[model samples]
Target: MKDYVIGLYEKAMPNTLTWREKLECARFFKYDFLEMSIDETDEKLKRLDMTKEERKALVDLMFEVGVPIRTMCLSGHRKFPLGSEDKTTRERSLKIMEKAIDLACDLGIRIIQLAGYDVYYENGNEKTREFFLENLKKSVDLASKKGIILAFETMETNFMNTVGKAMEYVKKIDSPYLGVYPDCGNITNASKSLGEDVIFDLKKGHGKIFALHLKETVRGKFREIPFGTGHVDFNEIIKTSYEMGVRRFVTEFWYTGEGDYKEGIKFSKDFIDRKFEEALKDK
Candidate 1:
């Protein structure tokens, strides 16, 4: 039996494809599951409003295709962040959080990866941080009520660029529903900027880590970097995270629309598979 589950981020495939097509592609790529993306865009945001029938259809499609959407990258808060200084935006953020939790419950998604940011595209201050923490507690309460896991994604911003920083908020909330699903690439970049050890930072979260985003990044770049062309040491990161009790992983990359994305997907899956195989060898 496999020691772990590996999933592909939905954005790793072209957005032009339907959910069925995406799940088919994920299965063809030999991925265990698909990590759905609910980014800040209106098109993605509207998915939260999907009807019960549509949700059931998608779930049925999963069983038929054999590739379930087990996780969600809920980055919608990057636009309507809970820590926004504006009252209307904060209210919208809470509403979005509620809708996202409800959607996760309907979709049978176990974990929702939250963007670790108090405020994006706006100046952050103590007030924003306070508002963010306040709303975050409420959000966790909602997730707890539904028994859905809400985990933070280690972002590229200094506010929460490392697993340790994410854990600070996780500890503050102190809810089983609120944990960390860190991005390895972002933490790698954060290590470079903060002069800290990536593995050590990861260990800080320890039992609080639910999953990991195995993305590639350079010293300054955090997105769309070709695997093996960046500085991230997948071998060590996966090994450390595995030892930390993380059993789920998702390859986080974007389609650049330059070459065959299928090739990219296959390559990423193979690369991560090798890493997991190496990391878990004889463990």
Candidate 2:
């Protein structure tokens, strides 16, 4: 049977919770791993006033609770302008990424998701592309030193918005540490294609996929729609991923502040379990 690792994005919580509360929420969800996006201005981290020892103690507590951090989803790109023409902004972004890399290394996490180049702007010319490549090379070099695998995620607006483009970028990088984290929901709006098409393209690019993000989209808006209520074909996606040798799959269900967190986790777990069982019987 395929081993399914269930997780949740830290951003799913309302920013009102303390660090202890966050831990309680993770326990409530009963997740196998915790995926967090650390922000520089996060008040919770500030309120904790945690030293390195304190942080380690907290990590130890999580381990004792049976939910270790499997991935660190760095939010560096939001504050620092990566892949931008602005020199100062670019430098700042790299600095933030460097800090994130160090934190991941110290925390013993292996997977660091990069924001890639911002796609909100339409001026992604050759210069911008080269900048991204150069910065990515630097990031990968650092990750390689720390024995970390850096996974670049595709956004709606970036140099690599599709699986093909993401694969192309990863191939150009030509490093074992550099790969793609395929998001099932992001590419749903590119055309009028079905979710199966997204899975097909991702399968084609599976050689470069290091991790998987399970999300769903409706029409053009991407959200945390419960599995099977949206367009993503979970069964085929999971089966193809398993065949391609992807061992880590992260479920991203953004909390909409309406329902119980336990219910969301159970619903997602049931969907994943059902799909894995189906895939196994078919195999």
Model 1 residue 179 CA deviation in Å: 0.8
lDDT of 2: 0.70
In the range 17-42, model 1's lDDT, one tens digit per residue, is: 99999999999988999999999999
Clashing pairs in 2: 119-157
TM-score per prediction, in order, is 0.99, 0.87
State which candidate has the highest lDDT.
1
Candidate 2 C-alpha lDDT tens digits along 9-56: 776676566556666777776666778776546652242234689668
| Weakest lDDT window of 10 consecutive positions for candidate 2 | 40-49
